[model samples]
Target chain A: MTPERGATAVAPVPSETVTRRESTSRRVTGPRPGTGWRQRLEIVVFVTPALALMATFVLWPVISAARMSFYSWRGFGPMDKFVGWRNYELVLGDDVFTGAVMHNFIIVFASLAVQLPLGLGIALLLNRKIRFRGLLRTIVFVPYVVAEVIAGVVWFQLLQPEYGVIDGLIKAVGLTPPEQGFLGTPDLTLATLFVVLTWKYLGMAVLLFMAGLQSVPDDLYEAAQIDGASWWQVQRRIAIPMLGPTIRTWMFLSMIGSLQLFDMVWVLTHGGPANATTTMATYLINQGTGRGNYGIAGAASVILFVIAFVMALVYQVFVLRRDTKEAR
Target chain B: MSRQKMRTFGGGGPLVYALAAVVVALTLGPVLYGALGGFRSNEQLARDPAGLPDPWVTSNYTNVLSNEAFWRYALNSSVIAVVTTVIAVLAGVMAAYPLARYQFKLREPLFMVFVLGLLFPAAVAIIPLFILVTRNLELGNSWWGVALPQAAFALPITVVILRPFLMALPKELEEAAMIDGASRVGVFWRIALPLSTPGLITVGVLAFVGSWNAYLLPLLLLREDMRTLPLGVADYSTEHSADTAGVLAFTSLAMIPALILFLALQKRIVNGLQGAVKG
Candidate 1:
């Protein structure tokens, strides 16, 4: 799916001539007068299965979640009790839900704050002709490819209070380790989760930045060099500016991924250490599945959806419009 | 772009290498430690938490490999991933074909529906999806219970990636086939499907990897023997909380399939991401 180079080059031909030729061919092959009906049938046959699956699985659940938020249901039985907006009120007023919302926003901002510069720095360094570039890139991306649960499990072991490798290393250097371990300490849990997230996702940013760099024509760099510009100046003025669209796109994705953060946090701490790392997703799961508070979970899910949808919409309008508009 | 020219134009120096080395070490350190820690006995780990195994015991690996539960998880994961991939690719390609090639008025709106699906995370729908699957569909504890939704989620990315590929196929080929009396279906089956193999492979690999690594859906849907590897790993880690080495072994073994698949198709996966981003 690399960008198609010349696909649009065929669009400028006169449309009337093309339609006339196609019509003449169709008239010549006049035996098949049922072609229109046949084509419509083909469209139906080809598209129906997917449309059905999506409607049933994706669209239905979304609508159901909205419907579910209005009623008080444990998980089973009939939907008799209509609680109206009580669930939303409860979810919003609850300190834990508010805390989860805070954590989600923290991750969303923290990811962009930490990963953007680090990934860009690495991508810049690696874009140079370097030995073992391919191998280095692969190693960086391996964690991303690994299952989130597995990564969480590995980190969970590494952060064990006394016996974990991290504490052991700290002690080896003559510094005292945390009594409750990094992940165990309520104050440190969110920070530790952020660190793990950076480890897992920075590679993607670097990869994307590198791809964006590849698309910046070599001549720009050459021209900058001819003008006696410094390396940093070239990157700042030419390379990075050219990467605007890529950076915005990456940030949008990162924000969405962060808001939905669940897998790693669930496996590692279960949003534990006194729920310090509870995201919207974890809070919903903790309510819906863990305690059978399906109504609260539904409300939380709807809130999460709305937050993500608004952010995506705003980003598309305010931030991403330029990139997409340029493409069009 | 040539290496020699790059060097002449001031390529990366020792400082760059040093920084890159540090980043790589930090990235791979925990993963390597986990894999190697499995070879150490509990006592050895207790004694030297960061040290290598004194005598690389094989029992941890052997025990996990021998355990019937581990294999069951693997089998369940394989089946679910395969089913999810097949359905997602087949349905995704079929839908993407007409959306890409046809001039129907509803095509744009339909494609937009899938595009909007991109922003809809499974977490948002997990609650009602649970109710729908278990209570309404009665697919609880079955492979389809998880695979169906997973495929549904997979559809957006699949269509997004595959549509451009279908659209990029030279129009003359289809026109030629039509002139030769081949029906639209004949043209699609004979021409469109064959030429879009790369796109198919890209989407297929992505779907399979996604299904294999999926956790939340399988966690809720599947119970007992139906649990996939991620759930199994969580359960085993909890059950064997004291057996750190065994947990490590199980975790490492669980990751191998995904890692191996990734290594094999590393290029396509990277390209696919680029494609998605660009699109």
Candidate 2:
């Protein structure tokens, strides 16, 4: 309901509020007059369970992580060793964590750089009246629906140095496979990871873009056609421009997802060979769970939280504001 | 318009079909390879790395299907997913109902709390969550440890989607129910719940799929025999590294439940995502 409705529902006659309150308080020893108590009970009953769960699992952990960041605890007993900002200093100084941050930024930019054009191109093609459109859409989107770990495991098997299908195909094409394989080679690991990431995520981009395309009114296309514009011209001059909000929104999602990339990397390389593919997530996991460096992990997590928060705030303020304002 | 213009604007031609075919092939190639690779023996794979099974063998699939461990993982995954979905949908519906229909002072701010939750990724809070679940709550190695947290994480999207659905319902029905002496709770149960089945189903399916495929939470909370399908798939691959065909069989089977769910309710899933993004 709207604010005005809520306001009136709470106090029907504002001028009588004091008298009503006095009368209700005076009659508290007897029966209540109206549905106010019943409504409040209903609201409390309905809202408390979710709020409890959220506070326990979601809100509490975030606060705990922030608190844990300043302590040198091994994730057990008492977290009494208050090391101040030493953990943050160590995490920032560690080359692995710094590299992880760089890798995260690389994926964030690479996803937008690569997926944008590729996804848009595919979306445009699929947007046309084509045969097997539903089937094609389903096929493209299957990878996105599949579990990331499973996809990583499948690709890991398929990327196994000599025995992997990809390597075998490369060999069959009269090209030499990498000596240590795509993922095994440190220099190629991040790039190779990006390829798999693209394969796994492009479906989502295309699906979202196609959904956005549906919102572009057909009248514009018809008008363009009436003006004797070519198909490419109509798309460039009309469809793409109309997709600005969708594109910006998708980019925002992509950036957030890329920053937190972990599942696939964890499965495929474990940020492997030479720590080439460590994401902010994998870095924290490695430090805390893998190495018992809970303090460092806590610091890294906070840094990640800040980075994601800042980037999201900046994007919303700069880019997404237009879309929301337009929606309003 | 000429035939060329019609071809350009109306139906995509042979070239478009060809491009679509290539895209489809690229998209499904790895998935098919993994699924079909299970039909070949390790020796057969060694002989022809990319070849189809000349004589399709059923042992790999049969072996994985018959394995007790595989079924154990599947059962664990199903139980966790069901628990997560039930909790998430129930809590989401309960919370969304008041936010959507009731007039309250804290409604907007409370809704914004859930909205803020959207930007809070699970990874950021995961380490502390693991500590909280294992040490503090002592829910380690238990289904609720994972299910409860998964459901908690699923709440934001669930509420975001379901709130709109509830809001769009005709307010007159609620008013009529109230006039007929039905309590708000009664109207919610009798009218709102039944009418919002589509939204409920959408959020339910999302929560289930999400819990089923979840890795980090289960990976941290569960161990050994308690592992879910994704973890099972990863561990099975590593343990059976020499058995390529068997590993493929295991991995392929691991994905089937989610794939079937997606294929069956694809339109709903797509629409749910669209609604979430639009909202």
Candidate 3:
């Protein structure tokens, strides 16, 4: 959970550090102009409402979930039994949980490989003076504006066996459709889910890349062309390198998004067909509500929170540090 | 190299047009088909699954529109989304002002807390939230049960957007007003709020659409009578399992409000999101 404040904070690292030392030295040199208690109270008044809600809803729940994970409880019972690590143990040993984790990674892999490339290609194509640029951009972004559950329902219809549009098109081209249907088959469910994910998500990626492309100086391309650079070379050495920050941002978003995949899976397959499409989110919801085992669900929630927290922290430190330094 | 070589892939050619067409088809084709499918009969859909309906029936739309359940769900969604947007925006404005204008010690850390809120996706916290709202708070089935958490979750992005806008306001205006003996609160209300209208609208639209499109929170919190549009969409799927046309119709109905909002603020949303990523 990297804060936006961190963006400004990280950017002015040297200056801020210098100012901090200068302020301390100034305090040593002379009496500082002290802020009144009234001013401090006013700051509190301004920030308290949001801070209160965030504490109750986000921060408190995170802490409570960690605690709840340690005790055995059901949906409507007291948390009397001290289960210790039993719930975590059960979750760790469960095949469904493991499968869900693997499925999340599959989505991450697919998103990195398929979604980003497809988005970049479409963005590049649209970046040119193609026909109906506005219309095409709007059309591509339409799916993203639509809700995830609705996307799930729409794709569910399209991927229906023999009767769906995909199968109909397959038949029209004289090919055999999958016999067990898309969502109904274990081997094909995750892959089909990937297709739907790509369709629903690629637009955002395209938009991000388009924004990045807009910032790349036209003179760079012109200069490269004058150097007798081929179109591919210009893209490889100029466009792609220039797009590093945006690409990194999109990749981070896509990874976290894949980790938290729930609505589509819940609506379309409910992690069925041998749990092929199960994600950690679906697993948590299943334990929490579908089964009413709050303790197990709490354990799952903590695990997910830890994974996401660690991933974000590591990504910020190792990956984004270079970008921030380069920007400075 | 010639100036012609500077243009990638010759800029405008048959091949580029062909590729653009393919991209368009792949992106918009399914949504268009789904929307049109609602107008066709179930039999029509089953028979000719990929084209315009010969006998485009209004019954599906009529059926969903006339159904009391659909309206109830839509009404619930509106109430929740509206309440959440209002609370989130108000709180965001209040909180962002201090973060932007003050150089207090807690300013960065407090702002960071709100930013960290963005990283906690609602999915992971549902369990504890369920317990806290239902058992501890006794807010089960109420609109606030869903709305409060939504408002809370939205604060990070709302504050993120608003703080920068607040920071950009000229301090001389506030100083000029203070010279006239106006209080800080009065200056904030009369000056800063009016100046940040664009940022407010941007955050409001984002929060509203997000609340309306939300599925899991309402799914967990509400009962049958209190079902939101998304839950209603799921209900339509289950209750009318055999009626694909009706399901699609219900889906289209649930979508229209959010879509209309997005279309109205399309430019703001697009630019705001683009700026968010770049920032």
Best by TM-score: 1
Two-way DockQ contest, 1 vs 2, winner: 1
Categorize the docking of model 3: medium
- Candidate 3 lDDT over A1-328, as tens digits, reads 2222323343445435544553553344232256467667878899898999998998889888888889888867567899899999999899999899899988998899998888888888777756677677777887887889887888888988888999999999999889988889899999999989898899889988887776666656666667677666766677767677789888888888898999999888999988888899999899889898888988998888888878888988888777655432
Q: If you assessed candidate 2 against the hidden native complex, which CAPRI class would it receive?
A: acceptable
lDDT tens digits, residue span B125-161, model 1: 9988888899889999999999999999999989988
Error of 3 at A139 (Å): 1.5
Q: How high is the lDDT of residue B80 in model 1?
A: 95
Q: Encode model 1's per-residue lDDT on A1-328: one tens digit a residue.
A: 1111221222223234444554554444333555677778988999888889888888899888888899999988887799999999999999999999999999999998899999999999888778888788888888887889988899999999998999988988999987889988999999999999999889889988887776666655676677687778777777787677789989998999999999999988889889899999999999999999888899999999999999999999999987665543
Q: List runs of model 3 lying over 4 Å from the truth.
A: A1-35, A225-231, A324-328, B1-10
User: What are the DockQ scores of the candidates, in order?
Assistant: 0.59, 0.47, 0.51
Model 1 residue B14 CA deviation (Å) reads 0.6
Which residue pairs in model 2 clash with each other? none
Per-residue lDDT of candidate 2, residues A1-328 (tens digit): 1322322232223224433443443343222348678878988999898999999999999888889899998877788999999999999999988999999999999999999999999999998888788899999999988899999998998898998899999998999999999999999999999999999999999988887776565656666677687778777877777677778889988998998899999999999888999889999998899888888888998999999989999999999886665443
Candidate 2 lands at a TM-score of: 0.91
Task: Give a tens-digit lDDT track for model 2, residues B1-279.
Answer: 242234347468899999999999889999999999999999998888789997999999999999999999999999999999999999999999988777668887999788778788899899999999998899999889999999999998899889867866666686678678887789999999999988888899889989999999999899988989999999998988999999999999999999898899988777766655555
**Residue A220 lDDT (model 1):** 58
